[model samples]
Target chain A: MSESDIAAAFEDGPAFVPYLTAGDPTFESSIEYVEALERGGADVIELGLPFSEPIAEGPTIQQAIVRSLADGMTPVRFFEFVETLAVDVPLVCMTYYNLIYQYGEEEGPRPFVERAAAAGVDGLIVPDLPVEEAQPLRTACDALGVDLIFIVAPTTTDDRLDPLLEHSSGYVYVQARLGVTGARSDVSDHTSHSLDRLKGYDLPAAVGFGISTGEQAGEIVAGGADGIIVGSALVDIVADGYENDLSVEETADRLEAKANELTTGITEQGQPRSERL
Target chain B: MSETFGRYGGQYVPEALMPALEELTDAYQRYVLNNEDGFMDEFRQRLETFGGRPTPLQRAEQLSERYGTEVYLKREDLVHGGAHKLNNALGQVLLAKYMGKERIIAETGAGQHGTATAMAAAHLDMPCEIYMGRTDTNRQRPNVFRMRLNNAEVTPVDIGRGTLKEAISEALRDWAHTVETTHYVIGSVVGPHPFPQLVDAFQAVISAEIRDQLRERTGALPDSVVACAGGGSNAMGTFHHFVDEEPVDLYAIEAGGSSLEVDQARGVAPNSASLTTGTEGVLHGARTRVLQDGHGQIMESHSVSAGLDYAGVGPELAHLVETGRVTPDSVGDDTALAGFHRLSQTEGIIPALETSHAIGWLEEATPEQLGERVVLTVSGRGDKDLETVLEETAERDIPAAPQMNVFSNPTTGGDGNE
Candidate 1:
């Protein structure tokens, strides 16, 4: 599908993106959680691939990776889980470049992307891959009709931003701060400034990191973001409720409630059709 | 012991290193059972002629009288190059030669292990490289200079907290890339499999010597053995040989940092005392008990002793504690400093701050509890720690004390002066 087609899916309302670590708590929960995220209002779901040393995560997401690894999670297992889940949401496997470099050759990203597309995934977001290094995967993703989303941090210079915007498809991920992803009491003022600069570009822009509550979702949408990405906070909720005997239904319901809270506020306060046109 | 003692020690490492760890484990197991080829004899010959072994066991008579219990010091300080670290470094280097590797690499914090590795590599006439944290290089300039003097290249690691942990990561990354010609000689018993076991075996010579020496002197085994645990090679080595022997109390003391309560709450919060606070987790490709949160992030641990500052302990030590083979304890930085001063003032022996953990435990052993005898592993000499001692003493405003004139008054043979 083209960018316009994906944009059309969100024309009726503001898009919701839910982020969760793959194989978190357990692989089964991650699969069910994605479906639950979609059902509750997520137009796209960012599935995080856990890494042993994540240089870019705060304590909360780092803890999620640990919990996932402790439960026997690996990159291979994560891809296999994605293949089996068969969910309908646009599954974007989000990860650092190290995981891909470590395991992508043996289990090629093309095959993984094809299987994910067959299993209902639509894109991928590799945070650390710069435009120079993204060509090979971008070609593979283009061949497979899978979107390759790139991140633009608040620190990205104008020279870097233009090329990133030119190469990016699906939606641009706007990091809220210079630091790693985690819950923070306040978002950076630079995020709003970056969003304003990104408005000139004709791609959908979503704001992520440090956005947890409903009020923050409304604020980001009002500030001109096409969508809002909620990650560490929602993952923290699921992780906090994780138990040895947690059923799939209970986990789904819990995640759905979180998704509803984030999406409802964005939809209610987002730009109306008249204002955008 | 729960297959890994609650996720603390296991094979959570890269696939490339697995064969090496397996080979090491097999070699160690065989060496322990039957030294049919006189491995220990050759090892001892090297120790005496080069590395130095059978370092004197001196009775701390003054401290013994003052504390009302007999205290014997196993002077690892007397070893060549002034610390017990060489015992393991020499052994591991020899193993590397046996394995037919041409180059050696290692990581060091406070530069002790780097210096030791450089010494071993120099003796073996092998190429050596040591990765050290930039922060540690600045603080431990003397040892850093010592490493360079021994002709080892020192790569300063500047990433991720800039400590021993980060140095280990950089070294591992290097080892992964250059696995064919390089042997990564781990400094302590904290890395992936076969390391904890191998280092423990080499250092176990300390306890084995203590066992024989105590038998000859006391005509019976002492009630307990104590040593400091930094990655716990010395403590585990000393404790492991006696694990099967009943009635011998083995204790490993960890740096408690500021306080026990604060350290426990920090839990790998970048302070030492891995056994007391670290949970089952993986780091540096080894499944071991680590001070980490629910998510696999490494925690910050605190310690006054630079040598003891780490986020994890040895897997074997964790296993020993889990199986009730030994007891682990913590002593704060202040108590360790006090122990250092007490040993100096009472016995004229300046102990390493890392070894002061063992010295501090002496306070817990009452005269009745210690019974007639006790032996402690004085893991390293205090030469490298002179600046640290002076700095700490100055900060604490300790009274100016007179230096004992042992060399001038030769009649007393430097005995019972304190």
Candidate 2:
């Protein structure tokens, strides 16, 4: 996972950012899915370590997280798994802040930021940690070479836009709607305008929240979003596959196929970064 | 830092909620700064006309003799909806009406806030939905009926051991989906910023009246002001005006169902003594002291009063606790029940289970040399707890006071109805 790799994806069409809750059915299945996601043309992979209480998740992701947590997805467990995981796409860990803070709570274990960096995570997106209260965590990430991404809301005022994007590393996560994370039928009408507002910033602008399909992903990216995050749709494919008679390999193949289809919808021909900047 | 109280309180919510929170902050500021919309006036008017404000500050003569001190109860129990909860729900619903929000959503623990919110929404003709834990809904059957009677839809949350935290999480989830059309009337002085500050302002009227009432009656402030803390709206309200008075000590009584000590011997975790034994952690979008286990996972709390069975205290109280401005004490379950029974017998006032914690604090740790004056907010009525009380006291061979029997038929020694 490298900064250059993520920037390179943005230089092309909208970088197709995809997410998977680590250890949804099992840790092994999740690792295989990440590798398959990379093969299916994922730009940067957002690996969500499951948490017990996710304040901002919708029914789809909430169920996935519950399943993952039931399967015992701790920060240590996720990090231990990621330590051996190898994928081409830069992996960013996205989850609630509590699991991160509770990481290594026993004695004098290394803090989550450093531990995540050592485990080879490239960036972080903690939806619960606003920039105002994100000092110590930000400092830890900064010292450990982990990028701390910031969130942009549709309700963000003009005065708040620059302040939020200024310190954002890796990329700016643009919340597509005024609600929690779930797949929506269409991209929000305000999303293109949000992307246009982020145009001046040098960071890659990725739109997420309520994106469930390849077409919505395509629409946001075509509307000039630097990337598109397709989470629940892909996670659903895995969940739905594992439900019935599908073997683990069959589930992995179905996930890989769906990821490939969604990837096809969002990515575009490569262009020089200088043209946009 | 601006919205925060000292190092505690900050708006730590999801990105999707920032705009709604900002709007609420702006609206609250306008009411305070301009008051041109007559928002505060309408809220005050409703408090007076509907909820019965300036509730009696009765001198507890019999209880005064028992404790050897002059004790006065700020009778919030007499308020409509039978608790101090109506004061806040009314104010917030008025604000919602002012904001042109057609719907309101709230989360409740003991069901008092739910019933209060439902009552306010019913008055304002707004569609209200309240989230209550399934356990709480079952535990507080009267309030559940009260909410339905007010035409507010009640959603029973079954997640996370079925309690306040889960109910709040479910409410937050609902709010995220409906933030555009729904105004979330948070039940206490907690949650993300603008909420703690705003809810405290709405509830501050309790202390404001107590201050004036005490000053008029005693020619000085009471030596101490005491109130129970759940999410700490009532205690914060009771302590707000007295905070600056050096002579007025503020004591926030927390729920200590069993003991504050985590008993490894019996493998019993400490009670819900959040301020007494909690560590600073973030929950429900605010930084506060939380009763969490060693691994930082929030632990379940036990309390005789459902209102105080929370993992976290209000951040304002957390700040006050850190600064030594408010001393937080935890009262055990048996002691609180004793206070409930004693207050009922002595003063003919059956306090809400939550308010009994404050009385328990007074009895358990009253001064050897009694102070001149004590002001306590009887946060709610205990008619709701009648069955619980009768069942609890059934085992004890306690006799009714001879004086109370004067109303009974002398020959039968039974009900006056007969």
Candidate 3:
């Protein structure tokens, strides 16, 4: 489908997306886990390409990447693992710029974008690549019909938002706070303020980071977010499941149950809140 | 000697860096066994020319007189980088060059070791990279600029809490990925394997010099030798040579931050004490005694001195404490700052904030208990701490209550409340 079609789906209701690192613990487990997330409630599945240094992540996601790397996960192998999954949900490849710069070379993200899209990846999240330097990847992704999602932090100013909104296709990623991703005890007031400020933009603004519980997910949707990205908390749930000595299938089942419970509760609660006078 | 204090000093690094640590251990062992011709000559040549060794030993006369004891200071501050850290950096950089390593990578807190490593690497014409926390880089801009001036690439780690711990984590990750030609020159007597041992050996010159100097001046070793324990490198270095000597009493002073009461109340006490309160645990890939929680999660430590602000102590020090070879003591920030001021006033020498903990303990010791002579390791110079000292002094003008005299409070019924 086209970028406009994907953006139009969010107008109906808030999108429920799930993210999992490729090859966490083991490669096959990650594939199974992603498919499980899709089966559970995920609208768009984000598959993180683990790198040695993940500057944008908090401890939970960092630990996942570390475990995946320890299990001999690499970029080439991660892409190959994605290829074998035969995932039904629209897959978005989330990775840092360093891994792409090192592995992509002069031909840049074109080859990777083409290969990834062919393997069923619908979009991408390159957190470190600012809008100015994103033109090369944007052109390549546009040619391949792949949506390149852009992120804006709470600290991101108004002047920076206009330029970013121009190139943004699928949906604008609005970080919940100024800090890195984690399960914060308190929701950021700035998240709603930032979303309201970005309302004039053309794209759907999905709020992420620190959105853990069903209550929080429902609140974001109530506050006018098009989608809520629950990353670290879900990764923490998967990590906790692994610690229980659960088999890959058992771990996937437990994580999917958690995602389903959280998303279903959010949607149910969200409907009543929005229907109220 | 088995080259291990316990299970603590064995090689526990990634398989890639095992050979280098082993090679360093082997070369150092061989060098120690045979004082071959030109061994000391080459070492001294490098020391005089590169490291600027044989750092002077000063006597803190006025501070000693105030406490009614004789105190002599081993001046590690006189080295090239204004800190004792250069002693290990110079040795490691040379060894890396000797082993045909093309690049040097190190981690730093407060930027002392980073600047020192950058200096050594620059002098040797080897490419160097130092990882420092973004918070530290902002706090220690002078040292960060100094490292950059020396042509070392400074990578600010903005991850985790963005402190020394995070910097070390980043350095370790970088080293693991580029282990082929990069040498991770660890800053302290921490990490796995020969690092703690190797760094101690290089820094052992501190005590070896103290032994010779004491014998020449007094014709005998002092009753007790004291030094501060950060990673326990300087303390271990000064104490290792005298461990077997029955007459010498060894002491490793730890940073108590504000007070033991404050730390204990806040549930942050253990992290403050590197040797005294730390327990057996693992951190930064090393099995050692660390100030951690029940689940082995490293706790936060607070100290006026950034250098001593770590949760873990060196493994060798742990073994030493276990064997009763050394006694551990904790000194509060007030006493340490007083010690810093006293040393500056009396000896015309400045001590690192880490070393002031040792000096603070000395200030509190009884004259008779201190005996005629006491030698303490003045681990690093206080130039880098000028800003910190001035800032702290401005914040608190009152002199610290006498540590010993506070115990004689009449209202508390001699229960030590001041």
Going through the candidates in order, their DockQ values are 0.03, 0.47, 0.02
Q: State each candidate's clash count.
A: 15, 2, 0
Once superposed on the true structure, which residue ranges of model 2 sit more than 4 Å away at CA? A1-5, A101-110, A241-247, A268-277, B259-270, B368-370, B387-418
lDDT of 1: 0.73
lDDT (Cα, tens digit) per residue for candidate 2, span A1-277: 4564456667766687888899887888888888888888888999998765678877778788877866767777888878867886788999777667666754221388878888888889988887777777787876787888888988777887876876678888988887777777876787988988877788988888888767667676677777878788888877886677577777778777877777777754323345655
Better of 1 and 2 by TM-score: 2
User: Candidate 1: which stretches are off by over 4 Å?
Assistant: A1-277, B1-8, B26-40, B261-270, B397-418
> Docking category for candidate 1?
incorrect
Please give the distance, in angstroms, between residue B61's alpha carbon in candidate 3 and its true position after superposition.
2.0
Error of 2 at B167 (Å): 1.9
Per-residue lDDT for A93-138 in model 1, tens only?
Answer: 8865444533433423465566556655677887545564467678
Question: Residue-wise lDDT of candidate 1 within B285-401, one digit each (tens)?
Answer: 555666664434466667878788888788878878877777888887767877887787777788888987788778765676466677788887667776676556544533333
Cα lDDT tens digits, model 3, A1-277, are 4444456546556777778888887887888888888777877777898754454566788889878866877667877888888666677889865355435444355867877777777888976565755787899888988888888765565666778788778888887765566787778897889888987776777888888777888888788777778788878867987788788888888778878866785576454312321
Candidate 3 recovers a fraction of native contacts equal to: 0.00
Model 2 TM-score relative to the real fold: 0.90
TM-score for each prediction?
0.61, 0.90, 0.61
Q: In model 3, where do residues sit more than 4 Å from their true spots?
A: A1-60, A63-277, B1-3, B30-40, B261-271, B400-418
Task: Please give the ranking of all candidate structures by TM-score, highest first, separated by commas.
Answer: 2, 1, 3
* Best-performing candidate as measured by lDDT: 2
Clashing pairs in 3: none
TM-score of chain B of 3: 0.89
